[model samples]
Target chain A: MTAQALHQHQPHRPEDGHKLHGYPPGDLAIWVFILAELGAFFVLFTVYAFTRLKHLQLFAEMQRTLDSDAGMINTLLLITGSWCVARAVAAIKRNHCRASAHWLLAAIGSGVGFLIVKYFEYGAKFAAGINLDTNLFYTFYIALTAFHAMHVVLGMAILLLVWKKAMAGGYSAQDHHGMETGASYWHMVDLVWIILFPLVYVMR
Target chain B: MGVHFLNVIWVALMVATVLTWLIGKTGELSTAMVVAVLVISAVKGWLIIYDFMALRRVRLLWRGLVLGWLLLTLSIILLAYWLGIK
Candidate 1:
């Protein structure tokens, strides 16, 4: 579809039930799913906190053995990636499909960077004989960060799909639910890391 | 114009991250510093949700749902941390 086709697209459709219901962005179904995911993480984080409190000294020592620099870099990557996704959504909202695709690609690059930093960080820990069974701190550390890393991979895949569709002019200023859905999911991943980084790595 | 706004937010988030990292590097387990870090995390989370996720444009109910969850999660974590410090 060309710019002309997108421009001809419905700029505003009140009957779509979105504005009628004063709905949130993206699919309402996605918002429900996103909340469920966040709820799971919330439970994990709460468990981590109380458990760490039980063994503060051990947690503190184990945390020090991890790589803060890598964690910091990964944090930066995810934040930038989230920003890029936001830009991608913004672009498509204005009927700029190609620009949106470009922004999605930039976001994907950030996702790749995050995974690379995470790979080396995990590798270093494993090489140090620090396995998941190492201790309490190591256990939650591996579990939380590893779970989040997997989400990053999933987010990347979703972003790739969004990118391919955007490149094909599948979204427009009026109908870009797919992009918002993917972007919302990606931002959740970023949000998880935001809390994880400080809670696990910095709050020692 | 919107892109510029998002860029400004990105910069703010980066600066906040760096500041938190520097504070962590101080190696201080002081309650004050921990509180500061948690506060920063909340702010970062809010920015991503409100702007990046575009929750600001949504209805009050949805905003409340997300932000309420955030507040609850952060408060619990902080409470646990404070207890651990004691």
Candidate 2:
């Protein structure tokens, strides 16, 4: 309803509204979607947390089998990515388009690096003769993290577009809509990793 | 015995307690300590949504979307409890 109202008014109205110099309304809409995705991921995280509390002993045993070092390293990688993307947003705000592009590239690079590490982690689990059907804990781990990897892929795609736009000087301090929305999505991805780290890696 | 090092959350909390003790000897069970940590985590989340996303001061409706996440969390826990029941 709100979208239809905005759409009906947008064509008739000139492009002279309170849009930031370069931020696009379409991008802001995407950010709202990212927030919704975060909502879903948090629901998953919350369920896992509560379930783990019930099966504390089993979870503790499961934790002992899992690769904490890989989890920790991935956590660090994501934290680094979060910082870089936050910098990218700040650079966009300052109209430093080139710097924003650089940060976005680094953030995208981290997404790739995360997947590389994740591949190895999954390989290790497979080599241990484990599969998603191994147990409830393993099932949740694979399902949630696989879903998370999809978000990483999505985030990388968004960052790539933002980087291209940045390089073209397409986003002005006022019009950098994609930057804000992309940052929101990346932050959601990082937030999920944060919860997963402590729950799946740290807790016993 | 060495499993103490395996559960990283325990180690982290233990480190936090020791560090807090060094700073002020505010040992564990101090409401100040537990509340302090929880408050920090919540604020960290707020910063992720508000600053990183630049939604620092969005309108009430937009803000409500973020708040809705907490409600979702509660519902998820309830659902999990039902599922866990046998």
Best-matching candidate per DockQ: 1
- In terms of lDDT, the best-performing candidate is 1
Q: Return the lDDT, model 2, position B73.
A: 51
* Model 2 per-residue lDDT tens digits across residues A1-204: 476542332110113433332222235566557667877788788878787767856766776776666766676666567667777766666677899899889888888989999999999999998899998899888998899999899988988988898999987666665576677778778766655654465434
Instruction: Output the TM-score of candidate 2.
Output: 0.72
RMSD in Å for model 1: 5.2
Each candidate: fraction of true contacts kept? 0.70, 0.17
i-RMSD of all predictions? 2.8, 12.3
Colliding residue pairs in candidate 1? none
List the candidates' TM-scores in order.
0.92, 0.72
The lDDT values for all models are 0.86, 0.62
CAPRI-style docking class of model 1 based on DockQ: medium
